[model samples]
Target: MTFPIRTPDDLHIEKRDLKFGRDDAPPRWWHSNDPGRTAFFNALSSTFPVGEKFFMTAVRHYRDGTAEPLRSQIDDFLYQESMHSREHVVFNRQAQDAGFDIASAEDRARRTIAWAKRRSPIQQLAGTCALEHFTATLAHDALANPEHLGGASNEARRMWQWHAIEEIEHKAVAFDTYLHATRTMTPFRRWLKRSVVMILTSLRFHYVIFRNTADLLRQDGRNDWATWKGLLAWLYGRKGLMRAMGLSIFTYIKPGFHPWEIDDRSLLKDALRLLEAGKPKEMAA
Candidate 1:
């Protein structure tokens, strides 16, 4: 099936400034009342503040060199990412309030991002591109499959829904920026670098997420086999989020991969309508 090719011209950044977890914290098991599932999302949220900063910096470094449309898209991407970071910071605080040591997880993410920053600019951009694709794939599933995040508290669910919507909207910005950054490099060399970096990034990203989830689970005295089993099942089982996105993830390393080639914007529109309905009139305007 041929998918319509989406470009930066189609990108629009919405500033929500939405807040959550301030008045009442979601229950410890916010997602489906499943401690394992809850910790998995909390672990992922804990990384966003620091990780998003890394992504913005990496993409912004190449903005001056990019031409029209893409240059403007990079600006939108940075702003949207900053908003994601802001909201996730609030969400992570709720995780901490729920008795999980989200600070430690954030610290680890900070250190990881710091290490990535020490690399060459292009390598950092390559890593950002890889990570962006990962989030975009996850975002696709989060919207397409209700069961993925079903049973979460309203605030938490909307928070993720908003985040997922924006993720899909600007999914291609970092990748296009990376391509522009490496415009002078040989195609083979560019592919090899992004491919290698993506492999490395994927390994470390999952390790950190799983490790953080385990740590959070331990805080709940859930170090038992069942907890671990459920967590694994949620991630890699037949209906696993990760398993479902395996093909989408692998497409990143294809010779001429571009995020919009997947054509999941129909999902984005439905998600946006849902999120917009919840927004205050002023903000929605």
Candidate 2:
């Protein structure tokens, strides 16, 4: 059954929880005290530049009228992504305050965004939908793993956990929007396009992670052997990061595949609590 697309009300950025970045507020994942885990998280943090660019590109695509239902999704997507960017910026600064060279890290992030922008719009959007699927799976795994983020401080873990929950929440919106917008494409062709995009984007993400990790290792005075080991461990751990990502990508080919279809609804209760606690005025349908 086709879900009726609804146009959400205009977003009020003013109503968002801006208190997230204040000085007295707790540090997010990027600034946690555990040196070993913090290094890992800082490396992971490098991925957000690409994430933000993807969402911004989606916002632009929807605003241009290429996707009908996505037009409404764009507002919430943009708002949430803007908040993500802001939080990460603050987190990056906190990392710098703790002695890392954030300026260099940010420079790399800017270069990556430029690369994403140079790709064709359709390619960019498809890559984003694939990444969204990857994140949806990662979010689920993260919520499941008892020690997934064991060393993080309470505030840091809370922030990342909150972000993960929301990522799962809207995971399918982009893919569904893309499907609706490109009505002429055959289902088989769409799946093929999605698979190709997923492979290419994963390679790009891996390249970024490799480069960023090398940079971090250089700054931290770590030997190449140790750094490489850490990278390998992250990918090959029991959770099988890349394998899970591939499985998530494959799920797109299944009939009725959607973010909510695989979701653990209990996690969503937390999101609902946050929404009600903030109580931002809801727009009339």
Candidate 3:
């Protein structure tokens, strides 16, 4: 239960170059046709292009002189994250074209990443690992529960499902890089550092998303009490994403945790096949 645990031996992360069609006329709730859900995901999409750059840079900071499987994984991790940023940029533009206030939300996200960039490189990588854990948890929830994505337009569903699959595929890259780079530190020090980073990152992460949600609501001219009420219900209700991810989010703090410890690759079988099946139709644009 100490440092330097093995990264998954099974990951084969190949970057997929794909695109989702933007509708000529899109609904406000592009995802699941639900305002709250759509706002939440819109917030995520607006953030990804900037956030993924931070993830890649933070991990790449440690790439020099890295050897063996992790070296190749790091290269592919960079490739995958770069692609995620590109795809999400296109998706976010579609959100903006749909009349959402994506530019304002992305301004907030940019400021957040700017703050992280001012921190030390180690801190940057630690924060990246923390956020990766959060994404992986949400990815698992989306893949495992059909309701999260249920009723969404096919293009929207397919883009997110593709993103989720890749998130799970490379969930541990930053953490593995962190562990290798920090192997000399005491276990307690390592744990304490990451634990603090995760706590701070999680708080900031939620604040940004919720703030962006409110921004979207106001832009839609639905900032009334009932709209806020609906957002709360969507977040905390029986079928809510927050309720489902409650326990999974805390798994990162376990002493000897590894991304593949849970073996959810079983979930990837269909996701990968579907992604492979759709690659040909990914438009260039």
Candidate 4:
């Protein structure tokens, strides 16, 4: 609703050291027992470890000169991201044990991160900002609309919902860091660089997710047209997660876009409540 809403002063982006799927392995088709849906989410999970590291690297490059509130937010962002990567590492292992080839998916993510590391710091931050927007929007959708993951097992659902909550909490850290890093650039140039990078980032992001999903599905022996059709429909059909997020995703390219302008904290609060409720009893205490 507004052009800017700083990360809530009272909202601490906590480093939740929670674990998921440590004791019980979710079924191979963890999301509604559907191979397409399962592979799609598994593909996304495969990228988190390396991808979050790159995000931290890019944001951390600009940390020194950042102002107070944002500096504190950056520290919290790094902590939350580290935890995300760690949990996803465990979740990816579960997918691997479920008979999918996670090594290749992780390798794909590593290669992308390696390539991104070669770019200038500001460019890399711009890329991080782009990807953060994508993640934040998807996270908001997943949390705001429960049916997106309604049928998933408790552990898997809680894992994803927890990730979504923190994502919404610190969604703007990368974008804010990018803006501060490029403060010297002309306004037009700043906009141009971020907008262009968002385009490039979207292309690469989609390619990796879809390609990895296809690769995983192939391992399940269902990479044919029929399987792809189901996957496509799951993502792009009516009531689809991606379809639901289309407009929110496009908001990133607006001239003066800020992640908080949409104000989805209500979703964050609800999801956080559910995640806390689902925690192990000892942890909850």
Pairs with steric clashes in candidate 4: none
User: What is the C-alpha lDDT profile of model 4 across 94-140, one tens digit per residue?
Assistant: 98888788888889999999999999988999999988888888888
TM-score of 4: 0.94
Q: How accurate is candidate 2 locally (lDDT)?
A: 0.61
lDDT of 3 by residue, 1-285 (tens): 224436556657767776665444356687766677788888888899999999999999999846668888899889988888988888888887787768789999999999999999989999999899888888887888777776777777788888899888888888888888778888899888888998899889989998998889788777678877887787677867766555555787878777778676878887767656654353422
The Cα local distance difference test for each model comes to 0.83, 0.61, 0.81, 0.86
Write down the worst ten-residue block by lDDT for model 4.
Answer: 1-10
TM-score of each: 0.92, 0.77, 0.91, 0.94
**Model 3 vs. true fold: TM:** 0.91
Q: Number of clashing residue pairs in every model?
A: 0, 0, 0, 0
Residue pairs with backbone atoms closer than 3 Å in model 2 (clashes): none
Q: Encode model 1's per-residue lDDT on 81-198: one tens digit a residue.
A: 9989998988987887777887678878888898899999999999998888888888888888878877888779889998988888888888878877777788899899999999
Native RMSD of candidate 1 (Å): 3.4
When 1 and 2 are scored with lDDT, the better candidate is: 1
User: Clashing residue pairs, candidate 3?
Assistant: none
Worst 10 residues of 2 by lDDT: 6-15
Q: Which parts of model 3 have CA positions greater than 4 angstroms off?
A: 1-5, 22-25, 274-285
Candidate 3, after superposition: displacement of residue 64 in Å?
1.2
Give the Cα-based TM-score of candidate 2 against the true structure.
0.77
TM-score-better candidate, 1 vs 3: 1
Residue pair clashes in candidate 1:
none
